[model samples]
Target: MKEWSVLLLSLTAAAFVLFAGAGTASAADGGKILIAYFSRADENYQVGYVEKGNTQVLAEAVAEATGGELFRIETERPYPKEYRETTEVAKREQNEGARPKLKSTPPDIGFYDVIFLGYPNWWGDMPMAVYTFLESYGSGAFAGKRIIPFCTAAGSGLSGTVGTIGKLCPGATVNNAFTMLGAEAQEFSDGTRAKVREWLVGTGLVK
Candidate 1:
């Protein structure tokens, strides 16, 4: 009876360690994640007028899968409700390399180890307001952090924004970006969620 009890106790201890190690490995790969995105609603391309932006929907899916905090990057001056006008404004901002002012103070980015940056691809690049958000945290905030880029666009996909982010944050690791059509993201369908989950698994952020 005593020998049987000892064997049972040893098995239980070994099982506990094995499961604990597996959990630790998953956490180490994911770390602390933040889903930071810049999204705009109202008369967006493909998805006409919407209450929620496409990129916002995608970011929310990412947040759900990874259990990451969501941060919306907003501008002090809101963009035009009209799609054409917004495009023109975005183009002009890009042309002049403008950094639009942020609406609210950003959270302390130093607490997070992984930043999942999402945005709408505007004129083959990230919106200028995102530029403001990235730089707002100071030059060293993103140092040694892992940045995962995601975007929603009409057809441009990620364009050259991935490379741009790598250049902007010299010390950060910019991973391959994930992108989807704005219309698809706006719909927020089961397929969209599945795709997001698969992508998260590939990144080792989800099991």
Candidate 2:
């Protein structure tokens, strides 16, 4: 009976070691994450007069799920508070290929192994400020890093922004993008969070 008891104890210890090793392996594989996004508050499409922009809400949920650091991308000159006026400004910026000046210095992106970029889809593309943010880092900063994009849009979804990121950061591994309606993100925050968590799990960012 004593020999049998010793054998059971040995099996339990082995199981514990195996499980612990797996947890460590998972943590090692999941590198440090950073959630950087551009969001605008005020009169927005669908959800009007928001203090927190739709993209900001979504980005915050992503940060919560992945435990990533949050960085907001703001322009030196704010966009119009009115939705129509903002769209016009966005269109002009895109037509001119303009790079709006950023309001703050960017974080040291070299410290993060994974970067989750979020923005609101404007005129079927990322806002011009996001362009400035990416270009500010220079192409070399993103080399060998994993970039995952998410967006809140009216109807454009990701609007092929994932491909654009690949073009901009050629050395970085750009993963598939996740997108949701701005209204859904703004109005149904709890559901949005759940969906974001599920998507993160599929992307291997969360378990």
Candidate 3:
């Protein structure tokens, strides 16, 4: 009986250490790829449905598929409440070259090799929050590392957003860019997840 108890205790300790170690490694390889995305937690109109936020759903799926970390890119000053008003604000801000302050600090770039950036299409480009995130970490820190971006766009595709990011971080290798609409994200289907898996595998970022 004493021998059995000792065996069980040893197994428990080993399991704990292994899991803890795995967590540490994940945060380091960009295998811990942080899902940094700008998703407003407000009224979002899709093709046929309404969503509070679409980026969150997409980011969650990507994180699950890639076994990575998930982080929300929120604004210190929230967007307008009404949809039309929000669009107006976004347009004016874009024209004036305004950068919205983010409420969250990005995850440790030291911990990630690949970063999956996502956001809803604002105007004909990325939201200003993304620019803010880039400005904070644009000093060639993650050079030679890969950055994979995905988005939930409305009318526009990537719309030269990837190029903009590349220009911002000249040291990073950017690829594996993709997009999905908000209404499509609402389903969270297996097909969408399969595509995600393929992208991760194809990029050689995961098994």
Candidate 4:
């Protein structure tokens, strides 16, 4: 009887390992999509309104359903802890072509088939850390990779950001990006989640 119990536990463990391995393989194939985003705790603008930290909340929801890894792009030079002060710093960085160094790197980005890039729109474009990230990785590691970009901001839509990414990573495939007003992010609701599911299905990242 004791022997039988041990055998049952061993079998259960083995089954779990096999199941997990299969899941990873499917995700590695057409089902895998990675989420890489940068969000600041200080300040943001949304649909001609002002807000703070909406992009971070949105990314968490997206990653939950997809079961994808989330990497926050942090800068070596931290932005001001105060919102007003941070806004001033951001404006200055925008004035100069600034690429604040990132302190953290994505863990083994080579594992995913598709990449979902997210960020809050700043100065009608992506934050400089994004530029730093792209330039650091270059077009080699991501060559032929399918990229999906999603962002939140004030009234400014994706605008020149996509164009700029095109210029930066010349050889990658980019899909039509989505821009959500940061202030509206709290209302993502069930409908917004459904839209994300639709996107995953369209990208062949889900069954």
- lDDT, candidate 2, 171-198, per-residue tens: 9998858999999989855566567666
Q: Which stretches of candidate 2 lie over 4 Å from their true place?
A: 1-27
List the candidates ranked by TM-score, beginning with the highest.
Answer: 1, 2, 3, 4
lDDT of 4: 0.71
Top lDDT: which candidate number? 1
Q: Report the lDDT of model 2 for residue 107.
A: 96
Clashing pairs in 1: none
| Residue range with the least summed lDDT across 10 consecutive positions in model 1 | 17-26
TM-score, candidate 4, is 0.75
lDDT of every model, 2 decimals? 0.86, 0.85, 0.74, 0.71
- State residue 192's C-alpha deviation in candidate 2, in Å: 2.5
Model 2's TM-score against the true structure: 0.85
What tens-digit string does per-residue lDDT give for candidate 1 at 162-186? 9999888879999957999999998
Using all chains and alpha carbons, the TM-scores for the candidates as numbered come to: 0.85, 0.85, 0.79, 0.75
**What CA RMSD would you report for each candidate?**
8.2, 8.5, 6.3, 6.9
**lDDT comparing candidate 1 with the true structure:** 0.86
List the candidate 4 regions with Cα displacement exceeding 4 Å: 1-25, 28-31, 43-52
| lDDT tens digits by residue: candidate 3, 108-161 | 787777788888888868888888887887588668767788878775778888
Clash count, candidate 4: 1
What's the number of clashes in each of the models?
0, 0, 2, 1
